[model samples]
Target: MEKLNWIAVDWGTSHLRVWLMDDQSKVLQHLASDRGMSSLKPEEYEATLIEMVGDALPDQGSIPVICCGMAGSRQGWAEAPYGKAPCTPPSIDAATRVSTKVSRISVFILPGIKQLPAADVMRGEETQIAGFLAENSDFDGVICLPGTHCKWVHISAGEVVSFRTFMTGELFALICGSSVLRHSVDDEGWDAEAFDAAVSDAISRPAAIAGNLFSIRAESLLSGLSAAAARSRISGLLIGIELAAARPYWLGQDVVIVGESGIASAYEVGLIQQGAMARRVTAENMTLNGLRAAHAKMVEIAQ
Candidate 1:
């Protein structure tokens, strides 16, 4: 049996994921829960972690735990704080130590990155950026992290130089599920032709997005546009607007999209439509690789 030497955690606003890892960074077992930062009090974090992984924890010595994401937010277990940008992701020295009632557990939450002057902060994606840099040390370009709030980051010299956030995903959910468009969009299907056309239309005339949005409903009523197509257009239009605004980041630059959702694919397509070459990597794998990088650095510090 493989010995569990440590724990890797990614606790976000909506979910918590834990990985039991060996000394060599091989994952032994994994678990996830819906009890995220928004669901727990600061004092309840230790108990919640124990409830999820107590059976797998070693009986003798304390196992080191390295975590990233919203768990480091001010309202989380302990504020790991934010390290400034144009800098590497924070390591062991920047981690926040959490005192556990259980004797065999030692937890450290990694600090995230903050961009001054513009006032933008990222919690979990910085670790993934660290992981990407760990492998592609020579990479210098843009990385788009697609989620509730998509981030477009600039990387140079193994550091995050600058970044911007767009509320495309949240807006999609709001407009599709709760707005007037909700009556027209089924939000459960895809139409590649409709998607591409919408991307081209939005990119060419981004300022006309308001009228285009109403067209989704008008067309549905007047010409019987399908709900699935309406959903696709809505997604494409928002992402298209973001691309118009983020042209400086992705235009003529190597682009990598980090995420594991359909929305990520949509971003890829939107970029390709603008003649930009873009590739995607799964967020789960990137997060695990990032935790591995942090663990290696922390262990090195201990030595």
Candidate 2:
């Protein structure tokens, strides 16, 4: 086994992932479980972490553990506080130490970013943004993170100028499950042409969205719309509305989609159709890169 130098963690709502890292920033071992922020109490964090990553640590000296995501939320192990926008990705001096009883480990959770006056906040994504910046020091424009709650972040001069979150993913889940549109969609399928058309329609006729949404079910029952087309349409419509709202961020600007999932591909397609330059990156790469960057910073004053 490779010698472990430190630990990198991404503890989200439903999963806890820990990567034992060597000095070269390479993962020595990855340990994951379902004990996420939502399932554990505040005090159980340290013990749980040790139970998962303890064997990777040295026999004597303590090692640093750099973490990001919901583990720093209010209900998490410890609140790391949100660093407002117009500032760099909260990884520089934003890490909060978790009081650990284990003498062999020290835990630090990175702070998130908040946009004032608009009531928006992000915990884990900021680290990913930081990692992107680390790779593209001069990149400016939009970075779209597609997930349960999608985030469109505007980056300039290595800072999060502003951002907006859309409920596209969650809404799609609900709509596909039991919404009036459920009868129109299937569990899994896609129609690239239909999707692109729906997206185009949504962007071109933003106001027609409310009425257009109902047309899915109506068309399914009347004109016999295929389940695959229905699924794609639903996805397209929601993502289309998101594009319309986030037009200011991506219009004539380079976009970086930091996820390799199907939704990420859909976002890339939708943006390309809108004449935007969008690129792709794996979620694991960005998250781990962000954690690696955070660990470098944490080493500055790591106790």
Candidate 3:
């Protein structure tokens, strides 16, 4: 326990990921919980950290805990003010230090990046971007992060040039689970052919989206479209529309899709279908790596 150098945390909306680390940046232990920022009160954050990592803390001394994500949001444990765009990822020195009741630990949360005029903001994804840039420092292109609100970020010279967000994922859930399309859609099965065709169709005729979504229900009722086709079509159409709007950001450029296999693959596949050079990379350990990068600077600054 005395060998513990510092701690790393990726605190997001729906989950909390912690890593116990030594000076070498190697993880000695890992822990997680569904107790995300959304579920925690500001006052409870200090106790929550102790409760989660008490077993692993060193017996006597205080340890630095570097964190990234919603935990630094205005409503989170501490409000880590956002750094404007056209800048590198937030560094450890810029982290917001949260005052704690426990002397055995200190918490520092990273700030996210915000773009002006567009009024766009990101929290947890910044960590992943930092991790990506750590390995591919010279990368200059677009990074597509797919989730409830998908984000398309432009990177150049190690800076977040600009970004835009889409609501395709959330829209998919709402239309398929709570809207009129519910009766026509199934969450399980997928039709690859239907999905591919829909992506192409939507990319070519984006304005058709308003009419196409409702067509899923009509097709299911009249033409007897299978539930699998309906579900896949909806997904393809929504993602396709996003690709259409984001075409200017991609087109002949190379794009890196950073996320889990499922959603990341969808973006890669969709972009490829549109003739864009797209590839998928798993998000495992990227957050931790990003935190490690920040912690490195933190250690140096402290010294």
Backbone-clash count (model 1): 0
Error of 2 at 4 (Å): 1.4
Model 1, 1-303: lDDT tens digits are 599999999999889999999989999998999999989999999999999889888789999999999999999989998999978877767888988899899999999899998889999999999888888999999999999889999999988999998888899899998889999999488988888888888888999999999999999999999988999999888888889999999988999999986878999988988899999998888898889998999888879
**What is candidate 3's lDDT per residue for 1-303, written digit by digit as tens?**
537889999888888988899889898888989999889999988888899898888789899999898999999999999999988888787889889989999889999999998999998788889988998899999988898888899999999999999989889989999999999987789888999999999988989997999898889989999999999999999999999999888977779888888778878888878778987776756787789889888778878
Residue-wise lDDT of candidate 2 within 1-303, one digit each (tens)?
A: 888888999998888989999988898888899999989999999989988987777899888888899999999999999999888998747689887888888788999999988879998899899888889999888899999889999999999999999988889898889788887888877899999999999988888977888998999999999999999988898899999999998998888999757989999999999888899988878989999998887666656
For all predictions, the C-alpha RMSD in Å is 1.4, 2.0, 1.7
Model 1, position 272, has a per-residue lDDT of 87
Regions more than 4 Å wrong, model 2: 300-303
| lDDT of the candidates, in the order given | 0.91, 0.89, 0.88
Q: Residue 95 lDDT in model 2?
A: 84
Residue 79 local lDDT, model 1: 94
Against the true structure, candidate 2 reaches a TM-score of: 0.92
**Model 3, runs deviating above 4 Å:** 1-3
Which of the predicted structures, 1 or 3, would earn the higher TM-score when compared with the native?
Answer: 1
